[model samples]
Target: MSHIHIPDGVMPIWFVLAGWAATAVILYFCMRRVRDVELGRKIPLIGIVSALMILGMTLDIIPIAYHINMSVIAGIVLGPALGFISIFIVDLIISMFGHGGVTVVGLNTLIVGTEAMLGFYFFRVFLGVFGAGRLSPGMSAALAAVLSLIISTCLMIGVVYISQINPERVLHVHKENPLGKIFSLEPEGENKRHKIEDKRIDIETFAKTVFSLGVFGWILEGVITGFVIRYVSRVRPDLVLSEVT
Candidate 1:
C-alpha cells in the first residue's frame, strides 16, 4: 500500500541517488550482521518470503488501487536483517516489471524495508507487553502490522511531500469504479476530489486522501499478516519466535 511507483525523471535526481546510496549502506550492514551459516540456512526461507511479498503486491483491492505487501509477515518470520534483504529482492524484481520503475527501486526498498523492520520491532514490543495478557499471536501481529503500515505510510507521504510530487503521479494508478461510471479512480473529472491537477500538489490534500484509502489497505494487510503469523507459530514456533529474537 505504501509502495511508491513514481517513474524516472519524476523524483529529483539527487533524491533518487540518495535513496540508492542509503539502500546500499543498509544492505551492506544487513549482510555483515547476518552470519554465514545462518545465511545458508535461511536462504530458502528468504526466497519463499520474497516471493510471497512479490505475489501479494500484484493484487489491487477492489476500488482503492491498494495492494497487500506481506512485509510484516516477512519480518515476523525472517527477522529484520533477512526481511530487509528479502524486501530488497522483492523491490528489485518488481521494478523490472515497472511496479515502481527501475529508477525508484532504491526508494521503494527503503520504504517497504522500513515497514518490515518496524513490523519486526513493533511485534517484539507488543509481544512483551501483551504476552502477560495472553494476547493471541494473530491479534498481536495484527496490531503490529497495522501500526507499522501507518508509520510507513506517513514516511511515504513525507517522501512525496519532499519531492513535491502531485497525487496523479504519485502511485500512477487508474481505475474505473464498477459501482457506476458515475466516477473514475483516475484522479480525473469528478474524482478531482482525490487529487490535484497542478505540478505541485497540496501535501495536506494528498496525505488526507491517501490516508483515507490507505487505512483500508493497512487493516486488511494487518489481518493477513496476523493470520499468517499465527499459522506459522502454530506449525513452527521456531521459525517465527525462536529465530526472530
Candidate 2:
C-alpha cells in the first residue's frame, strides 16, 4: 500500500539515479553486516520470508484498497541486514511482475527496507519496555508495526511530493517533441483557465482518493502484523529475539 505505482518515465532522471545510488550504498553495508554470519540455515529462512512478503504485497484488502507488506515480520525473523536483503529480492521480483515500475525498484526497496529496520529495533525496544509476559510481547510487536508503517507511509508520500515538485521537470516533457505536447504543463493560449481548472480538480481528486483514508489502512496492517509476530514469537522466540547481524 505504501509503494510507489508510477510508471518508468514518471520520475525525474536525477531522482531515479539518486535512489539507485543510495540503495547500492545501503546494500553494500547490508552485505558487509551479513558476510560474517553463517548462512547455511538462514538461506532457507530468507527464501521463505521473501516469499511471504511477496504474497502479502500481492494481496489487497478490497474494502480499503490496502495491501500488506509483511516486511516487519521479515525483520523480526531475519534481522535487519538479512531482512533488507530479503526486501530487495521481494521488490525486484514484484517489479518484474509489474507491481511497480522497474526503474522504481531501488526506491521501493529503500522505503520497505526502512520499515524492516525500524520494526526490528522498535520491537526490541518495546519488548524491553513491555516485558515478555504472555500477551505483552504481542502488544509490543503491534506497536512497532503501527509505528513503522506510519513512518514508511510518510516516506512514500514524501517521494511522491518530491517527484511532483515540478511536473514538467518530472515528466521531462519537451516542447519540440510532438508526443510531449500531451503532457505539457501549461495550457494553450486560449481556454487555458478551463484546462488549468480541470487539471487542478483531477489532482485534488487523486490526492483525496489515495491518501485521505491512509490511517485505517496502516492500522489494519499493524493488527495483522502483530498477530503474526505473536504466533511466531510463541513458536520460535529465537527468531524474534535474535540480534541483527
Candidate 3:
C-alpha cells in the first residue's frame, strides 16, 4: 500500500539517482551484516521469504487503483536487514518482467524497503515494550503494517514535493519541453493540462489525497501482516527475531 507508482519520466533524475544511491548503500551494509552473522540455517528461510514477497507483489489481490504491497509483512517476519535485501531482489526481478520501469527501481526499492524495515523494527519494539505475551500476534502484525505504511507514505510525499512541486525546477523543465505548449503560465483560456499546471500541487493536497486513499488499504495490510506474524511467532518465534539483535 505504501509503494510509489509515479511511473517513468514523472520524477526528476536527481531524486531517482539519490534513491538509487541510498538503496545501494543500504544493501551493501545489509549484505555485510548478513555475512558476518554466519547463519547458514537461515539462508533457505530468507530465500523463501523473498520468493513469497515476489509472489505477493505479483498476485495483486486488489486492482491497480488500490495498489497493495505486502513487503511490510516480509520485513516484520524477516527483520530489517534481510527484509530490505529481499525487497530489493523482488523489485529487481519484477522490473525485468516489465512490471515497473527500470528508472524508478531505486525509488521503488527505497519505498518498499522503508516499509519492510519500519515494520520489522516497530514490531520488535512493540513486542519488547508491551510484552509479546500480552498481545496477540495478530495485533502485533497489524501495528507493524500501519507503521510501515505511514513511514513509506511520508517518504513518497517528500519525493513528490521535492521533485514535482518546486516552481524553480518544474518551470525550467516546462520551458524546455513540448509539454510547454500544452501547459503555460496563463491563468485563463488554457487547456485542462495547462490549468492543472497553473494551480500547482501543494503539500496539503498531496497529503490529503495520498492519505485518504491510502489509510483503508494500509489498515487492511496491517491486519493481514499481524495475523501472519502472529501465526509465525506462535509456531517459530526464534525464526523472526533471531537475526536482529
- Say which candidate scores most in TM-score: 2
If ranked by lDDT, best first, what sequence of candidates would result? 1, 2, 3
TM-score for all models, in order of appearance = 0.83, 0.84, 0.80
What lDDT score goes with residue 193 in model 1? 33
Query: In candidate 3, which residue pairs get closer than 3 Å at backbone N, Cα or C atoms, i.e. clash?
Result: 1-69, 141-226, 142-226
* Candidate 2 segments whose C-alpha is farther than 4 A from its true place: 63-65, 175-210
Predicted structure 2: lDDT: 0.78
- Over all chains combined, what TM-score does candidate 3 have? 0.80
Tens-digit lDDT track for model 1 on 1-245? 68886777566555777789999999999888885545667999999899988888887767455789999989888889989999999999988887887988889999999999999988888888778343477788899999999999999999887776554544443333453243222223334334545656678887898899888888898888888888887888888785652
Which is the better candidate, 2 or 3, if ranked by lDDT?
2
Candidate 2, residue 181: Cα displacement in angstroms equals 13
* Tens-place lDDT digits, model 2, residues 1-245: 66877788766666777788999999999999988899998899999999999998778777443688889888878989999999999999999888899998989999999999999899889989988689876888788888998888778877876655344344444545465455433223223222222221244555565566667777887788889888988898887787676
Candidate 1 stretches with Cα past 4 Å from truth are 132-135, 166-199
Candidate whose lDDT is highest: 1
lDDT tens digits by residue: candidate 3, 91-192: 888888777778788988988898888887777777776675735566766887898788888888877776654443333434334645444332222343
Backbone N/Cα/C clashes per model: 0, 0, 3
